[model samples]
Target: MVEAVHTAVAGRVRYRVAGLKRAPELKKLLEFRLSRTPDVTHVSASDLTGTLLVCFNSGNTVEGLAGRIAAIVEEYRSHGGGLAPGDNPGKEAGWLDTVPGLTPAYEAIKGLFALGGEQPREPWHTLTPEEVLARFGTSPDTGLSAGRAREHLTTYGANLLPESQPRSSWEIFFGQFQSLPVALLGAAAGLSLLTGGVVDALLIAGVVVANAFIGYKTESEAEKTIRSLQTQVRPTALVIRDGRMSEISAAEVTLGDLVVLRPGTYVPADARVVAAHHLSVDESALTGESLAVTKTEQPLVGVDLPLGDRRNMAFLGTTVVRGRGSGVVVATGLRTAFGGISTQVREVGETKTPLQGRLDSFSRVIALAVLGVTALVVLLGLLAGEAPRTGSEYARRFTWARAAEL
Candidate 1:
């Protein structure tokens, strides 16, 4: 049932629903019921704020709508409604008490995957430092202790995207043969074998293998170059751990880790600014904004704000060109925006090029032609050659007649 009601804007009334913090499903149920009411143009609910927005039809008023909606909700609850199908309220409180971190994880997951889930891209520009700390379950004074940090690292895994397993040389070589031209070459080799052209078949097979190897070698070399560049650019980070400051490899930084940002230092992970001093970041690498952005510590209101406008968040791989600040690392490795992109690069399946598509069509035509030619050759051979079986049958019959006469 609604705990309170207030006008959020003209023609829009907001209801503070009770028990929404515990029973998130109630929000949807409440929305479902409220939207069905006549003259209600729209209904939207936020479990985070325990509020629902109800818009009335033009010329219609929400003057008495709040009381009416509240009465409907209270009647529904009085009749034992709004419970999840399998839920037993009697045991829910006990389970919540027994489970450590279950409630928080539930809330986090809800915020992460909900319709408007996912923390603001640049929350630093939108959220206060204390709010940031509260959001991540950390403190500004002491930072996360060693034990807690280790637990989070273990739970979330290293703050990085999983490295794709290196493809074996044979795998790379075979992958090149997946193309249309190679398929056509394979068909040609098979036809040669069927026609008793053993040497010719072997020659075509050799060419196909050589071409695969050349493509593999070229790809492998390019990967090697990229790896070398990555090693050369690998950055170090300054972080506060167990209440003391230390410099560590960027890869070691994990979620909830407090990272110290300074001018001329590369951002180690995706983090929100908790403290800043004229903090201006050169985000051109990520946002293409040539001018360094000035950041501040203030809570922002809204959802899904753009990255460039999220002046409070610092992304990994970006350099702090001016000023210095501290940020709580919210994402590491593959979970970071940069890492998300890298994972996409690896997971995206290769698409057929336009040339490959045309070549595939050509290969189909060639295969059909080969089949037609082979059938014609076989027909001609059968017509020209004597029938061995018929000749044998006649010889056997003549032998049998001779034996009987003798």
Candidate 2:
């Protein structure tokens, strides 16, 4: 298995594998294998570092992407074939291949990546209240007709955060063992077990298991907290549909639907203020400022104001602490600022901690020291008349003998 090297904000993933480095033939074989995978936009392998970077559509999950690469690596290790018939490997190089530089250039290209291609965005904040209403195919006097609302809902899907796919408990538990320190410990335990120091091996494995339990428990709690916060967002919304006001589930709210907001209401989507009566929102959920921010319907003059200063917009997850106002929903779900942040959190790659880095270095040093000691012990044992066990084996056997005597 290869380690995930990097992942860009736009869904490009890089994997670093030492086995394929300097092996041009193998690299080409891998590139060919990956090219056939579905949803993979591009594949590139660097001969210098044996790094394979793949770009996929936004819909692809990281786990699925990594599994695909692992499968390809396994295939190369097995049959080890060249490019299949009629497979011109050179044809797969995307525009990214012609570009200079590596990670940075790929990131720039991915930042502009769009799902289903980009759609033009209307500057609703620049328009007047009446103008905004007209553009949405609705009016101030009457909201979207029932039939129109249904069509919008079908187009936009539900206004809700996509639930994360649940990982099996065994997978989560096993993932903890991937750390460098754990790997070293596992090797030590294996060596101990081979020498018959069962107690010592059990103790080392116990530490590993304890560490995994702590990590798993902490992650489970954090997930529960996030779910609680999501539930706090208003579950139901009051919207004017079919020329009449009705209470509906927040998920039923659609674009161009005229939403009704008042004190104690949580905005269901990112919206532009159309009408307000001293509208003030407690945006602390987003801005972290306890004070309520006042909002106005008058077109904001400046384009570059912080979320708190925007004054004429209401974001999802923020509560209407005071006054009353109505805004046309502009963005919802993952399109909202809150939703974008959530997406980033999910896609964000794990960074090595300072201690983890030191541990990695320590692991290398330990590996070298162990190899040297093992070689020296083997040489001395061979020089002696009777064959002797290796250093670790000798230690384990001595411990077992002593325990039996006790």
Candidate 3:
């Protein structure tokens, strides 16, 4: 049983769980659960230590991750799942619903973190180039045939990002009104108009419009950062097709396609390096680290690897700065590492910082309190046979007098 810790260093933490070293099923459950969390990047159990280690994004706290682990432990116990190795833990597989909306496998996140310890040992990165080619049924020397390429194109779709379609100007403009406060203000405006407060309604409506417009303008400015990714693609790439070297638009590059890499070239899709002659690349576009990374056709070991350490793989939107190498396109489109960043940036509104979430909760509480107090005051006024009083000048003077009395 892992005791819950209130604090931990950001990004990485470890918990000691009894019998987990010998209980493979329990270990898998812990790894699968943590791997599904949006902020958690890596999870592994050390059979030697009876400990579960996790690495996550810096945006989340260690306390939250530890709580999740503790919750899993409690839920497993309450459901009569085994905590000891002799408890026949495999029978507890059906109890995974304790964590809402989580899938049993971690394959969805396998692509993003696979470059280093960010991902577990998936097939492509762990396999040699020849082995990868055999699995894809493509030739390392001739690449995919034109007919097979067409079939894979149908299977994988285009080599373009799907989740990150540019927000239209109108979408950006209208999306600004989708927040809770904005909805409440819109309701207030409607109520003001219905009550024959046209001037007051217009003033409130004007404020809403002005606020939305200012937001739209500010977002339009920020939209430029998303456009920067558009510039990262090289537009065209050289590939080996039909046993002959040819140049094609990067978008047409698909799964099983053998993309030739050289100096000053951009990788159009995520690929495994089959051959390399001193290959190095500028991966700053995806990782934000400017150091040029060397490429190789070697498999890396250890659960502590990061994306930057995945030297055997070449990711999309990264530039080849030195030497030459070729990688089999294992993943395409939004499945690439670069596409993962695009997806993250696109859905950032849903992944609120912890402080932002707390502030939003506090705002709702304050709003409800204000509404309840106003309703009580109106009830008291009506019962006393008096009208509900208003006027900011009276409110200000009355508040001061009450404060002095207190």
lDDT of each: 0.66, 0.68, 0.68
Which window of ten consecutive residues has the lowest lDDT sum in model 3?
112-121
lDDT (Cα, tens digit) per residue for candidate 1, span 1-406: 5544777578787778775544545554565556556677666666555666777876556656767667655654654555655665564442223323332323232222212213234435566788778866787977877667665655665544455565667777778878655675676666556655566567677877887778999988776556444433435688887789875546556678888889998898888888999999998988899999997766666657787888788998789988999999887776677877786887786577999788778776765565566456546756988333553333332222222211
Highest TM-score model number: 2
Q: 1-406 in candidate 2: lDDT tens per residue?
A: 6777686556788888656665555565565556546666566776555677777786676778777777666655554333453454555533334433333312322323232222126656666888777777876767888777666665555577766764566777787777655666676677688877678778777877888999888867765556445433336677887778876656666678888889998799888898999889999889898899888998876566667777778898899988998888877677777888889978985577999788778766765565566566656877885455465666553333222211
Which pairs clash (backbone N, Cα, C closer than 3 Å) in model 2?
none
The alpha-carbon root-mean-square deviation between model 3 and the true structure, to one decimal in Å, is 21.7
Better model by TM-score: candidate 1 vs candidate 2: 2
- Stretches of model 3 off by over 4 angstroms after superposition: 1-122, 137-140, 165-204, 207-234, 298-306, 338-406
> Candidate 2: where is the Cα deviation over 4 Å?
1-120, 196-203, 206-234, 303-306, 350-406
